[model samples]
Target: MDTRELEGFLAQHAPFDSLDAKMLRSVATAATVITFPRGEQILDAFTDPTNAVFIILSGRVDIWNDADRLREAADESLSAGELFGFSAMLTERSVGPRAVAATPVTIARVPAAAVAPVFASRPGARFLAETLLSTRHQALAAPAYSSVEELITTAPLTVEPTTPVSEVARLMTERDSRYAVVPGPDHTFGMVTDSILRRRVLVEGLPPATPAREIMQPATATAVVGESAQEAQITLLDHGSDFLVVTDRAGELRGVVAPRDFAVSPSTAGVALNEQLRRAGTAEELDTLARQAPKMLADVLGRGLPSGRVIAVYSSIVDTIVRRAIQLTFQRHPDLSTEAFTWLALGSNGRREAVLSSDVDSAVAFVDGTPPDEITRYRAVFAEVDEMLVGAGLMSDDHGASARRTLFARTNADWRAQATRWLAAPTDGNGAMMTSLLVDGRPVHGDTGLPEVARVFSDLRRHPGTMRLLLQESLSSRARLHSMRQVLSRRNDTFDVKTYALVPVVNIGRWAALSVGSAALPTTERLRVAAGSAMLPRSQASTLIEVFETLQRLRLRYQLLQIREGIRPSDVLVLDRLSAIDRTVIAQAVREVSSIQRRMANVSNYVPTADWSSTDGL
Candidate 1:
């Protein structure tokens, strides 16, 4: 290419586009055109350090972080007229990213020496300043503390239960504290805060002479010192409390910590958002707060919380919102509140692996003798609750997995009978699907001791045919790892991470749990229990557990990124967007899932061959 043409190309790209004609001519004169075939490493931070920045003349380049670390996805894919290799030159750091040709590539390399003075110019300096600021902001964004113990600023002030409210307030004022802990009978404790005093004493017109215990709110939200700060954030969100009590290993109170104490923290933001959720008296108000959930997930995950832990935190918030919705509906229909029923969270929410985009898969189980009239009202209340959830950005399950659906909402006796019918003929009328959903049903609200579902699962050992059918269903969703290379190369192709990776592991976990008579809800715990019972080898279980987490992390990161970009979040992930390392990891995960499914195809050894009468308990 001509020097004039190269200079024009440089003028079309950033930072360099701001360069003067003289500087551009100098860069073009000093440039060397190099051709790298597909799959060639153009620049490596660890080896072959280059002092020149490459301007892509043609083809595509994928800029990636260290491949060994699996630290993050590809930084970007650069096409014609785009630049790479500047970060290493700008920072003079060896720890820079690797750039590879995703296609056969042609590039013009401009020496760092020639570009140095160009970058020092006015417009170039402005671009450099912005880049530096972004780097600095990311560094400062890391959470300052990792554990709940580190967040406690001071020792908790304790007062006797008999102390007057005024006396407790005086003590708090003297100590410059905003809270006082009041110990109760049997090592239980309650908290009296500034808000409590204002709400209970000033607004309610309670006497100043009232006992501290009278105004104290139960300190049900407590965290251990060793617990992760993310866990504390979830606890605060779950309880919608202003503060959480941190305790030592001996179960003694250590200190009181409030979200306000930590400035510009994810924990603080989560608590504040959840407080709004709790105080929302109307569905619209709750919906507005609930919409911030994706942002919360991003913030929490950005702070380096594990993917599984972040999902758990998200699910807890969803539970709080669902419970609050139920509360609001019951408040509106007091007649329905009199019914004895348990609200069941099914599917992903039931397993506590809920994503923000997941539909509300739920049901309701009533006590045997609830009046028919009351049952009608209960159904209406739950339907309203479903509408409220939808209003709050949670979609209802499209497959009729809701309390409003007559098939799902039933009395305890009905549930037992339904389970029996499903077990009797697993292929009849979506029996397999119903079993998969209800097997993991966990009570999210109301009377939670509904044993119909668990009792049915416990008796799964007696029905070997049903167990085999369930195992077959679990193996049905297999991934074709052989075609992953072709799939990953297609720029516009997308795949559902949940269906391809996550569901297979979840299905296998569920089947394994039934195999061992374990009722573990979380996928990880189910795999652990299966391993413990020798139903699955410990190594395979451990690998599958890791694979499950990897898929979940990728799914969540993709959805959150989409949400940030103002795009509607979903389960599908673009193949070309994945880093080379991520693609490799996912391919390995697919292979493992496929391998396990193949191994379990021989159902005899997979299921215990014990005599049914001898192992009746299991």
Candidate 2:
């Protein structure tokens, strides 16, 4: 385009529009037009730290941080008139993002010398400074400690339970330590620390020869060796202790971690909330914990943890709270045998995708044919547990679909019968809902009888018609994508992301897994399993997983904001509230979901062989 045309385009776009005619002409005159074909690398930060500012004059360019492995979807596509490559110029730092021509693109490259003159102008300087600051803020939000192993210290001081208190103190003194680990009667590690010696030994005038086990705190906190530092931190604080016993995958004790090791980080409110729930011997304590959950959620989100990992941590915390409530309920009703029944977390909890505002979707599955009196006692226990959960901020399902309802608290035989009925008449509304719920059911407590449930699910997989019906149902919802004209015309609107993005991805993943008789409940795992078994294309699976994680992060940020503002969280996200980068990511994710649906439509036609029982494929 000519200089006049370039000036007109610059006048219509952002910060350039704020420039006076003199400054605008300077920018337009200095702009050199460059063209890149589709699939061409435009710029790499590592090799090309171009000081020139890039404005997309036509077509599209995708900008992404190549170094950001945690943020797989941290990409933004800019079309005509959008500006990029300004941050490097303003901050005087190396360009951190790589750019590529997503489509055949023409870009205006204005020299750093010319752009420097614009920065002297007040409006232009303010805009550049704000953009630079925003970029820095986002970079800071990325995860600091990738894994908990980073925090694991060397082996902690160990002592036998038979060791005398005097001996334990001497060992601690020699080691220059404040704590020691002792073997518990329950075969778990117990903690002996200076506090116990000061409070019990000295204050109570106990003999120095008393067994260390008598005063050591029972082992209540532990984390897998591979868990994230954030998870370990939450666990330690949740148990109201500074220390945690780190264990390997085999449950063998590895080492101990303490808050001081990590510089004595401030106690997170979420951890305190978990602690309260665990120690909640009474209903009132649960109520208090529930009320504090929103703030705790706000705190965790504020810490800038990755959204997917944050959800996992929050889900685990919720699980612990729910499980504790069940334990407390069993204590109240001693007649109930915890082994006879299992508590099943359904919906988001079952999939481990739960967010701040997720509702309780759970049920109870008991062994077949318990005595009537014992059944009565089990019903009471379920009722109490449900009440506790509701009180702890997990509102029950509106349709009375929880363990508190008799419909869900069924025997193994009953669930099998229900599964059979649902498969037999898969198109029915109730059947579809039940099928969706049962597909995601995960045992959270007690004897789950999962093998029998898995057997029934495998049997359902034998019916090709059932798989066809589920695939159709899964694709019923279309992705929420606006036409180009519609997107350009709309201003400041919000939509329910759950309906448009999350549900469709979840349904498709579930369909893919069940078609191949894979029992992986989590959506990401389901996609991985489907890809591994060649049921779905690996490339498509990877794209779908990326889209799913992006949508999840967006939804979580929106919900956490709502929680922080004292409003109940929801899936609706205001487009105006998101950063320009985030808006582009969301749009890309939605398009990807649409692509996955089309692929699912093609895959739905294939029917597995009658003898295809491939549980081990994943």
Candidate 3:
């Protein structure tokens, strides 16, 4: 191949693509073209190190973790433009996996010494390190249970809207039930419970002649009988309701299922934990409950609950802990009014996608024109909240940039100014970072100033320049894949599921949502909106959503394992620990992310003329 052809090939791939012109030319010159016949053994870990990186030009190679058990063990394959053998060169240790040409292959043999200068550069170094060491694991399959009907113990007590409150109470008492479903017009049902009887009737001095409907609270949610218990649990949790009316296909109320029914025992840690969190009055008491979180997670997973539902439950618990912390903070500083500011959960927590491994990312947006003295007191309140949260085992943001910090905590006017500055210079690194955080902001406590925040983001979407900048930032991280060869060459045991798989999907979904001015916060919801609006093709969006969910499930499962082993949960996963099915799922998910990235590139076309040069480099 000519120098231009070689350079073009290098520029088309990663690490090399990040290199400057001079470095690219040097790499192209130093690379030697080589070919191997089909079935040729390329490298064996038992043999001496190759001392070179092999970048495929054509054909294929099969990599196996165990050469002797190649067919039975987890393996991967590599195609054109993929590099391998670098880990052996860098570590100077015998590689762990064996690679063989799966088809007649052509490759460029780049000596490690020749690429030394490029590796010395920061981008190249980080890329190579990530490629070599990062690994991930998958969750164990949960037991499959059939339906919510199995959890229902008794028939629902139904009553008419005009039934006397006295008669309804008498029937509930006779049935030993705390709740009764009052049928409403148009096939709806209202919930009348003991709590309502106490608070709305006796406490308010309501007459016994008051109708049942007058004291009933409308059911916010319901579940079909044949649905899985996990699905029912999710429905109940999503609506923040203690109980869900179970219905038949005809929509007739059959029974009720509460969150407690899913627990293995009456005092199952998962059920008891929530009660403990609600009653927790001190940081120490909350911390004690927090320690039970891992056990609760394990219990839920053991019951074969769906991963999405598991995350929802876990997030609910975390939310309770955080809100309780805020309540405690207020008790410590009675002068500070919660109505003066809004506490926002940012990042994964904000999106309601948090797992055991998640850290706290939060901010406070105060009401306009708060007194300076009160602002100072509010800062102290926020700081106390953060301290209590951290003490209860929630990891704080890396820079401690929560509501306690000036950067995150700001008045309504200050936030508007910040948003304007960010939109005006969207490509500025700091501005871009802040914009990403703002996109995921969710109000957890106090007055929700989210409408004002949403308006700012919507305005950014209205501007062409802002859309272009967002597209650029979202495309900043490409999905990383290791060919069979690359996987075999590495000594590291863990993979970074977040950086390689999860983050790319998140960024793509975020950009797509913002491009269409979507108000969706969760990644899956954003993709759904994008697809519905034709911002993303339905087929592609569906695939991307499925892939994102799969990655999340795997990450949650891995974190559960870490917690069981008495280690701090994190994103790094052990590939060898995964089942064959999981490995296959992960490989397919990686490819799906790459495909989405390419599709997104084709769709983003509104680049600013002045930034065209920078865009070309990316």
- Every candidate's CA RMSD: 16.5, 20.2, 26.2
Number of the candidate with higher lDDT, 1 or 2: 1
CA lDDT of each prediction against the hidden true structure: 0.76, 0.72, 0.74
Residue-level lDDT for 414 in candidate 3: 85
Per-residue lDDT of 1-618 in model 1, one digit per residue for the tens?
889999888898777887768888999999999999998888886454468778899999987644444356666788998776665565444445578899999999888898777654545644543442232222212243367887775678999999999999999888767789998776678999988999998899999899998989889789998987778877775555777888888788888776543322323334445545666888888888788788667866875677888798788878889988988878887655534888889989889899966888988889898766777767777888888998888867656688877778888888898888898898997899888999889887766553587668777877888877887888898755434665567543666777778888999898888778888889999988777443467787898899999889988998898888988778877878888888888878988988877776753454464431122222
Angstrom error at residue 510, model 1: 2.0
Q: Which prediction has the highest lDDT against the true structure? A: 1
Q: What TM-scores do the predictions have?
A: 0.63, 0.59, 0.63
Residue 181 of model 2: what lDDT? 90
TM-score result, candidate 1: 0.63
Tens-digit lDDT track for model 3 on 413-494?
8888888878888766488888888878887776644545556887654576777777778877877655354578874555
Query: Cα deviation in Å at residue 221, candidate 2?
Result: 10
